[model samples]
Target: MLSTKSFKGVNVFMSRNLVPPEVFDALLDALKLNGADVFLCCDPSRHGHNDFHIISSPDHEKFEDLKAKGCNLLGPHCVLSCAKEHRSLPKQGFTCCLAMDGIKVLASGFDMDEKVKIEQMVTAMGGVLQTKASVDVRFVIVKNVSAAKYKWALNVLKKPIVTINWLYQCWNEHRVVPQESYRVLPFSGLTICVTRIPADKRKEIEKIIIQNGGKYSAELTKKCDKYKVARRWGHIHIVTRKWFDHMS
Candidate 1:
């Protein structure tokens, strides 16, 4: 449960351009319900509220500056997306980490249960876990953006740094989401091709890819990325949607 005291005198800001408009509305509503001094910076004339102030620009870097002034970030990945958003999510039964197999990840600044959840998320995603950051660590998941590991991943290795929410969002969507929408990034890049699915669903899959900073091709090429199919394509990289769902 949220308490007014928890949010008292706290200023919360989110990047309007990074968050989809629909999601922005819901996020604002949720924050308001929680008693947050929440503000969304976009066109100021629109979305004015008695409860919070609005910044009229899309300069997302303002959010970083606000952090220095004691503002809390509360949006998906705490960034805006330059990708297209689909009206619908992926089909159910599909889980989060189908493309994650053999990938390596590290978790930092999370408690024991949260740490276990990270391990489970990676393991379910078919990724290996490491004790600490290393050359082998491809994904670093953290709750606080200020964590050392998160900073190191973003600044030093330039690897994918993502929030724990990335895992939950991926689980809900049943496909890997775009890294740009995360606080850090869950993966470097992923590409997928589909087969044996309805035409409408194929489009949804493509939206998942594009919104997450991946390129999609209409036709399968010999040298393209992974292919998604119910059956194997003569050993061309592939995984059944059922298997992808079971990855969680």
Candidate 2:
């Protein structure tokens, strides 16, 4: 399907790699769902030890049938090169770099010395570098997906913040270690009033509190400074000092 056909300013370039049978199934599904077309690059080296076969009937099931055809999988090198070149078109848009198992690796990692080559190719094509997370297939949207990237980064870089909020709401949700990471910092000499559960639970909670420059209470008495409640984790809430202070 490498015919020189284009759609919506986006070009599909299938690599010479022997795509796993299941992968082709997913690809067909994605194409139909996203209304995308296909492009194929012919490379003998990528065909493994088996000869290349021309698949005219590109359907989900047909793609799956090719799985046991016994050909080895091809590397993504051809596709990566095409994507780099595609980035040069002034209106080519974004080219998403995808990988398997929702694990994304930067195309730049393939050949670090060619960094300028890829960047220049993208700049000329009016696109950017982005990775996609997909269990079956990953790819970049080739446009400004910075918002998506930021969302991913937040979850990865601020996992502790997320864990803290999650554990605070329901200390019993996960193992005690999670709760132990959260501490209630006392302010204005107010003893934090907390529900005293068990010795182990109290110890874990107290450790988190002390680490964060806070104190813990053994019982929910009126003399307690503030109430530390692990509430439903709202990611944004976890990032705030107010949440930390309140929890502490």
Q: Which one is best on lDDT?
A: 1
Could you give candidate 2's per-residue lDDT for residues 1-248 as a string of tens digits? 32332123333434434454545655444433333344465332333332323232223343334435432222223233333333211221221221221222223122344544444333322233344443321222111112333234324432221222322233222112332334222231233334534566666666666655444556543553322422432221112434544545
Question: What are the per-residue Cα lDDT tens digits for candidate 1 across 64-134?
Answer: 34334433222242111101111111111111324464678888878788887677556544466788789
In the predicted model 1, the residue pairs found to clash are: 18-80, 18-81, 77-182, 77-183, 95-245, 161-184, 161-185, 162-185, 178-212
- Worst ten in a row by lDDT for model 1: 81-90
TM-score of each: 0.34, 0.22
Give me the overall lDDT of model 1. 0.52
Give the TM-score (vs. native) of candidate 2: 0.22
TM-score winner among the candidates?
Answer: 1
Clashes of 1: 9
